[model samples]
Target: MTKVFIIKFSIFILFSFILSTVSAFAQVDVEKMAKNFNIYLAFPEKHFQLKDGKYSGGTSPQDFANVSIEKIVIKDLNGDGLDDAVLVTVGNYGGSGGFYELTALLSTSSGLVQTNSIVLGDRINIKKIQVHSPEAHSPPELGLIKQNFEILIYMLKHKPNDPACCPTEPTMECFTIHKNKLIPCKEAPEPPVVKKPALYLYPIKNQEVEVEINPKGKVLKTIPEYREKWKVYVTKNGKINGKYNYLFYETTLNAPIPEYQRGWVVSHKELSRWFDVTLTKFGLNKREIRDFKAYWLNELPQFPYYEIRPLDTQFVEENLTIKINPKPATVIRVILHFKGTDTPSKLEEPAIITNVRKGFTAVEWGGILENSPNSDIKPQAKYSFLAQDTGVVVLRAIDLREHKLSIKLSSNGCTDKKALKSIVKKLEGINSQVPHYEITLIREKPDRCKALISEGTTIVYDLKEEFGINTKLPYTVTVKNPIYPLITDEPYFQFFPKKELKPKPVEEDMSLKEHLIKATVRAIEMEIKRYETSQQRDKEDKIDRLRNEIEKFNKMKPEDYILGYPNGAESSMEMFTYGPLMPPIHRQVEAIIEEPLKIGSILKLTTMTKSGPFYHIAGINENIDIAKELKQGRYRMKLYLVYKREYFGFIQNYYVYIAEVEKQ
Candidate 1:
């Protein structure tokens, strides 16, 4: 067996270590604020009671509904420096009818605390929701737009008492908790109507804009933008049966909710209105309609994310701007939250890595490795890498003065333990290999086998060829001593004939026709034997393999053959024969010339193997000339024998032409 060694050693050894540190970078602490604003974990059902008072506490096992967090946005409700969270859930719930909730959870050192339970929509309903709110921002505000965000809230028919129970016109409203009391805004205005404002609604700035070409000129995908905020209010003249109670509220005690004024209905209609205006007004296409069906804490299925009829939409942009808020604390709070179902809590679901550094950037500075000096490496016990839709392995490099290191984190593909260790050791060794040198080796071949040679790069090789009739040859390469191991994941090298193995090399030529005929005869013998011995065999498939192999040999020049064996027999001009083989041929037969040629044409040839005549091209040999020789009738052409068997073998010889054709 012929073996080839691939040397993938990088000489530039980067002296670095996978510094292990505590899990300090995973969270950003927003110090505790005023009293009475204590954070608690709500178990989705049973009113969100005080922490450890009656209902499940925050992040407790019982409260977690097994699910993944898709979206997490933070906003301040009382201007307290501390951020509150809105956790959006995704991934496997208890199948159909199982709720897909996106509750607004209050974030704290205590963990995610559910404030309001909102359902996104189901597979069927989600489509409709998309039509209603293609880019659903939690709360709709005319501001800068970013990602395609949509929100849909479906409420149950109000079941209240004393005239304020049913409304003539059912609309969305916001409920607030004050001094441990549920207060519904009675004076909340019906969903507002603003004729899709004529402000610039497209062309998001500072982001990659892909322009795909159709029959029309270049067109960009439309990306709708909006805000996630609301205005809260309280009114005594609350509408009952969609009409104000004339007797009770004759006076106007109109005032916005004190602390809750900014928190209002992140409505479904507003979402729908926005979708219509942006998608239709601009131009963006919807490829997927994801439905999210959310259930109440009681597991009562309600609110669907996308449930609008015929929700498919598309768009094109004009000009858009990203409203950069100088103070994210004022407009946005980066917090972590997870979405979940009522039954199986999604508390433990790994939070998706969002609005943070990409994995590539993080992997640098030892973030991707299992163990480092700067951090503790914990195996994500519950979720497999495949199940992780998104996750973050944060790393912070703080000098002695605690100044954050500005190094970029690059994601590397070394997930396995062995691979990761190799990388770490290789990098650690760089400092000694080459004190102050950097080298990069680029592969010359098509494959990814580039060599990065630097003073610090460590490499080892054993390029010796083995000799034996039937032997398992092994070619090994080990690179050490550099600060970092060469990151050559793949490499390739040309196989050259060993000098000692061949006493003397002689060049010879062979004819195409003669090669093809001899290969066919050999193939016929192999097929017949296989057919007689095998319990179940097809004669046609075998014949096909035979023919393909012969054609392959005819196309190749003998000199380029990897097999260094001399031609089996030499045939002279006086009498030449390749010898016949005994056979009731069973192999399928067909022939193909690599290059169709005229009389005076030159063609390169090679041979391959397969089970059937319709075999795929595998290997190739040298080149041959079909032109008439200077001495007429003296044909000098190379030929190769082709066979369809367990192993590939070849024979070579030169041929003489009996006749020649004149040039046209």
Candidate 2:
């Protein structure tokens, strides 16, 4: 059994983003509803009116018009991601019984629309009536609940043979809007859990870590490709040794949300000490605590006091199927939540229980700390990365000309090196009614630039040159990555070539050139993993820490196999860079080695912008020095060559980088 410990750390309440979502209740004439309103309920089958919140018609004790908006709160009721209104109204007809109804007013783009009305039992006394939890979170606390709207209604119902005025049997009921009607939420096994729970990973020994979870709902978003189940090596310092030092992946799962009442209540001033003592007890190391604080320190709300509650660890262990491999001996996971209040809430201190960190221990800490109105943190302005999600990469609108193929695709500014040679599988051709070919867009190298292009860039692939596809005929081009077709509708045109195609058909044997390109692309991708790496928290200190980590990593023992080193490059490769040999013609010419070449391979070189060649491959490396022919002021060039190595029986290749030369 995995001895896991989870903590919910609530630092302070701060609103994530200030959204202008005015509630429908604000527009609703609730005062008018309490005054003269029509009540359609079980007891009062006919229309009954309540003028000024009361109607006592002396025609009979049963003829009474008692209509009042008992509880009016604002929340989303129709899953439209907007604030709606829910009201509990009382009606007095048939003297002995009092009719209580649940009414929903859904908010629309134009105005509020009254949707459904439900009746609670007659002659029941409402104990507590509210929309949110004890925390009293506003409608801005969206994304927590998904499909349904919930309201807490606690009341006392009459028992058998009890007095008409007062007969009490207290009961609490939770009601959610279903299919535009309010119903008791008893069918669902558990209440929904909070979204974005960051599960940090800290392993004692340096080992590849992979966590797989089976959430009731889908895993909405998780960084570092959790869906792929990529094995990430985590160092003792809790850093995922990679280009980006991602420690853990947070997920939004559907499970029972754990609630904790027993915790410490403190003001913002007492936070530092609170973190040191409480997190220490929770078995978090100094480094982990620092990371936790750094992420939330600036966003901390400056309320008079706060209620810190850790979500129950049991809820995490059972509901969330978190399977860690090479199973951890000890695990500590904490999610802190802070509720800011006007006054200090006296809370009972819950006993913290966690096992000592043994071999292969794992520690995860994250929380959902919402902000109050008096929060110190102000909402930041939104800049538009504003591009629609690629969902990997969306490919559509394919127009194929004679030699060149124009494709409309999703891009992130640096998509020029998105792919070199693509694998085109002619699954169904000439024989089938709708000719189909599955084209796999292989991104030979990742676009390192962080430019967010609003409109995606276009990809113009030379059918005879790039992917080696012949576009003389028409055939529907289906991108196999997402099974999306190029030119989805009528007039689908794409020709799959026979001899020129680098990736041969799945059924046919691969040509020597196709086999080599496939092997080299894989090799280049593998080498790209170790490029430019750093880890930092979310504050000013994070910069310093990342700098320190990079320096430390660079200075590690040579035997440790330092990060950012070329794959399989044990000392053979040198920084392929040079300047002018003669003095009068002071030229600084440079060439980026696209790939390493074998002994007899051609030494090709081209201008940095790839407009024209500075010194193109005229002869093999063994025959001539390509640099000698360059006549330039200061030229940047690109060298295209193959770095092939025989791995026992299989062939492997690698890319030579520019950064590797800087160190030399």
Candidate 3:
């Protein structure tokens, strides 16, 4: 009986455990969830509020308010089986008005993530909030509304005319997660259409009148029209109710026009007085009316005076002078017109000149001139002037009298003689030397390699078949200065091929070769690092020594070294080669030819590896005769190999020669 009781109690405990686990996973704290999502609640603390239900000593009553979290709902979103939270919040200022907002939080593995927060309306009341989760289909998708759940919020949007007790109507809005953002489910309504007043132009006998008409075609009012043919001015009074907003030209017979006074209206109706009109009451679009106004007011007045002034008949002399009177600090542009094919010998290109002080400005003209050295102006050329201030000009181009003159000139960059000369000199002195060499090692066939050599250049040598040995090895050759130590400590010989070769190891010998190759590469890396560090240290030490010597020299009296023989003069003078060092078999070395090669300097060429020396040739004489012989034909120099190894063992006891041949 006791055993049965124990079994039954254990079963009850297991059942309770399972139920607790499920509850723990399903339960979510709404407040904590909202805070985790960074939900924007219209809480009273963010704005003005009343303190302690009364005004504080210095705090404003309207500036403080009471805020509260209204409602929160949690449901599975995106069919992920994880509950997401939505928050509704409201804030009430001391008065009757308040604010409403909605926030959404997505449930993530780490925590609740805030998706979106949007303000619904100011002084609004939220009536209802509901989460609509539809039934899942064969395949579930995540979005704002198509497949995922959405939150519908019913609210009363406060209007300006709404009474304090209640808003006029209820507004419905839906929101959901879209691209990680909370957006409205419905698009915003379109704007209301606005009606504009129609403008009409009427021709009444000799006068033209402009009138404003409503959409029904009834005349509203007639606008004032300018009637003068010559000397017409436009004046803009402020905007009028239902009147067309355009510039209206006004005719003033005796009054002078002001300078640079823009913003005036010039209408087609006012211009129709000077020009003939074909329509009585025409309905025109804004752009068409603007074009018609510009044509009559700005362009049509100049048509009657299109005649080009005759050259020989008007001007008897070669030169002419024009005097213009413009207001102070104003620019006057003068243009010239030429008659007949007789081009002017010398004419100052038309330009706008500013007059700093009020007085008569003199402009001289050399009759009908060419625009350029190769181009000439046409015979019937016309000129016009656009002046800022009211002024009269007397132009005497030989003896022609005209009120206005137009000249066109081309603008381009001016040439600088000094800059051009400097460029020409540089072009004439460019270097044309490109030194290159090709060497062919004679064997069963021929192993040939060609290269362009310069200071600090590196060359790679493929010596797999040299001396009739077909061993795979990596090699690099560099031109070096003999005086300087070798740039690298890695051996010129490698027992194994490079990593990119992908050599197969089927037998014991093949496996051994692969292992040796890896070992050689590792050794090469370490040696390269060691050599680079050593070179950097050497350069730093040399720089320090030079700095110290400079300091010592600066402190010394001029007579110390300049007046007497320097210390260790004889000991420091050592015989050295000035030409480039012979490059290593498989390494990079800088060619340090300190000065240009002298005719008789001896160059020592040596090739060695970290293991030991492989080849050394001393006392190579540099002479004009040898250079001439090399330039004419190829000459092979014998290489003496020493301390030969497995990879390079075939070359041992064999005469290896290389030629320094230049291409024709």
What ordering of candidates by TM-score runs from best to worst? Answer: 2, 3, 1
Report every candidate's CA lDDT.
0.24, 0.48, 0.31
Query: Which has the better lDDT: candidate 2, or candidate 3?
Result: 2
Tens digit of lDDT per residue, candidate 1, span 551-609?
65456554444322333221121011122211101121123243333221112221211
TM-score computed on alpha carbons, candidate 2: 0.33
lDDT of 2 by residue, 400-454 (tens): 6665667655444566534433655544576655556555554544444555342
List the candidate 3 regions with Cα displacement exceeding 4 Å. 1-28, 31-38, 41-65, 93-95, 134-145, 158-161, 187-664
Better of 1 and 3 by TM-score: 3
Residue-by-residue lDDT tens digits, candidate 3, 184-205: 6543111111111112221112
Q: Estimate candidate 1's alpha-carbon lDDT, on a 0 to 1 scale.
A: 0.24
lDDT winner between candidates 1 and 3: 3
After superposing candidate 1 on the true structure, give the runs of residues whose Cα lies further than 4 Å from its correct spot.
1-66, 91-93, 107-112, 124-664
Model 1 residue 531 distance off true place after TM-score fit, in angstroms: 71
